[model samples]
Target: MNSTSKGDRLEDAFYHYLLDQQDRGELIFGAYPPENCRIYRKKAYYCREREADVEFDVVLELYRKGRDTPHLYVIFECKNHEASISEVYVNDFSSKIGRIFPHAVKGVMVVTSRLQAGAEKVARNARMGIVKYDEQGLEIIADRRGSCFEHSFVRSQIFRSANSAKSLKFSAYHDGEYFSSIDRFLGSLEPELVDGIRPENGGGSLPVPYLSIEQIKAAAGKILKFADYESGAVDLVKVCQSLSIDLQFADRAVLDADGVAILGSANFGRKAIEINSHSRETRERFTIAHEIGHFCLNHERYLRSETIIERDLFVTREKDGSFNYERLEYQANAFSAELLLPDAVFLKKTAHFRRDLEMRDRGHGYIFVDDQPGNSATYDELLSRLSTHFEVSKQAIEVKLKKSKMLTDQRKRNEASPISRVFAGLISSRKS
Candidate 1:
């Protein structure tokens, strides 16, 4: 193949590989506990020393939801080329990892090419696992190139090509997919430095009075207005418009087709927020509220750079508002969920309807299935009636509950027990 054509094909394949993994919503981390954590790729990782030697596009830290996880890290490496791996290469990568995230407990690597001599052996010897992307596909996966998103990459730790975006969309928004499980997982994450997140100034912060779930929701409610007809897609569109951050209600051909993001122009006019239109009666509303969290707290910092990392995946950040992939992803998700499902709403919902169903630390027994504001008080009913009304999903609601310590658990568990996804495959996903 011509050099240009070869590069183009490689690029196409590279993205396709990412998208396919994205759709499946997971990665094959390894043979041990952290082995099964799900991974969501962001812009990539970079750490500049002084002025340059600045590391270029490295794979973001892999992700995995630990059970009652106080904090667990999913470390990973990515190399997109067709070459064999080896002891020298693995050792070099390992040494680099040691320097970067010194305290990290574990890590994984993605060699999207042939494994070099002694590479697999070295990885195995190091007690790490290797995933190879070659001419062939996963022997266990039926779809092979078609793809499936578990967001918990432990299934088959290997790949050859990417799949349709639809599969990932399914993993992201569906009620029963990885997100729901993530809700459960989040429900279990314990705070590191547990204490009141109060700031020095008491004039009420931009989004809330404090760094908390209740405060975030309260902040969102103050900023947004909801309409009764805001169901499916229309309501989400209206919410986005009401906020003034900028968004459109575009349709998608998926299960959680709440809305599709237009990618560029990030959130209408601003370059930070991506303009996504969702249609889920409950989910779309929650998404709108969630995006509001981003606008209120993160937009400006992000717009300063063309490469906005999705979700605060990394827990680390720089002064100029740049951060690692995992931190950004986690922050964005937490911010959104906090705003959509605040404690005030939860309290009221339980107050009015506490008599009807059984409430537990993780979730309520009510199977709220409303396409709009009426039925399924699970989240909407609770939030709508509270001082700060915002629509959130039961999963998100549960997550909010755990984060606020409404429920108590302080350990992160790497969930390896396979379960069906909340929603299997769809495009426009936010990592499972």
Candidate 2:
């Protein structure tokens, strides 16, 4: 017979989990258990819209002891099931949250299985959150905080991996939304490059000259000289400025696009790079590096005019469900990966750190760098560490590792669940 009740076990698990998050300084209060905290288990709230009372799994709040306005409030609806969490569940949670709590309260739908397609988007649109926790460490599927905590979260690397719409623009730069930013960027360029910058014709009638892989590699090598190869991190802004390229940050709405842009010979008589200000620092750095690929590979030579603008040479996809593999975009993406985390250094660090990790025999999932032996880290920890050292996102590191055959290729070595295959597939598809 089971000793503990399921309800009691769930409550205890969540209580302890929150306590651990508190100790780790994940909570906004910055105090363990926090002051004036209230965790109402199986609480009922009257829903004005529904004209009925809805019961919640857990309602957690932390704020000033006597203040009328709460600093932070989170409502979590737990779902333990084999099926994935769908849009319907997310919509229901959003509706309940709207009726039950103030606008500032963040709604969280905690699920055991994965989230279905469009579910996360629904949650984000509703200003709610999603958490997928299991024996593996806590994976924040989606967590949209209220305005008060948003600034802090944006600055926190802990929540840096949240999914955003910006990633979509990389696939199709020609989308209607992207034209505004592209036009602005093109208009800012100098007349010389903007007016008559065309590829050197080589007897063929083709107007543009396609760069070879060797040429791209050579260009990347030049940029890598300015970076710390051992650390696999480059000062992209400094490198750009060294080449007379100005770095500019603009809002996403202004760009109507994702990623960064390399402006050839701006009106200031210098090259420029426009990065999406709303993106994370890691993302900005990668975008800068990607743009550097374009500069070094002489992609501007292909630009004919402002009206016929060349697609960004980093992330442009073609029809038939495949990326434009034979284009400058693919080459630039390849260059960015190689530049950000050089193969040799990346492999060496992973080999050494993973060896040490193996000796320690730590557990899986998110782990602090200096975590204890029994509470060891996962591939995610390794990726996070590399990301910090390399100044990129864990996803970037993971992709690099996979490309280098360190995360895959079982013939070389054997390790159970080197990384989450599901996560790897998800991230890979997202990139494509």
Please give the range of 10 consecutive residues that has the lowest summed lDDT in model 1: 418-427
Estimate, for each residue in 3-46, the C-alpha lDDT of model 2 and write its tens digit. Answer: 23543455556656655444443443223234455666777878
For model 2, what is the error of residue 186's alpha carbon versus the real structure, in angstroms, after optimal superposition? 20
Measured by TM-score, the strongest candidate is: 2
In model 2, which regions exceed 4 Å deviation? 1-214, 226-232, 256-269, 304-326, 359-376, 409-432
Model 1 lDDT at residue 339: 43
Against the true structure, whose lDDT is highest? Answer: 2
Segments of candidate 1 deviating more than 4 angstroms: 1-218, 225-235, 249-288, 304-327, 356-391, 400-432
lDDT per residue (tens digit) for residues 1-432 in model 1: 654454345344434554454455433212212233433433333444333232322232333344443234544455554444456767877675555545643444545443544765666566553433321221122121222223333212232124211111111111111221121222112122213222112221122112343444455555443433321222445555655545544453321111223221234124223433444455444444445555565543422211121122222222222222223333444454444443454555555554444433335223333344333344444434332334434444444443444433222531211100111100112322
lDDT of 1: 0.36
Candidate 1 local Cα displacement, residue 213, angstroms: 5.8
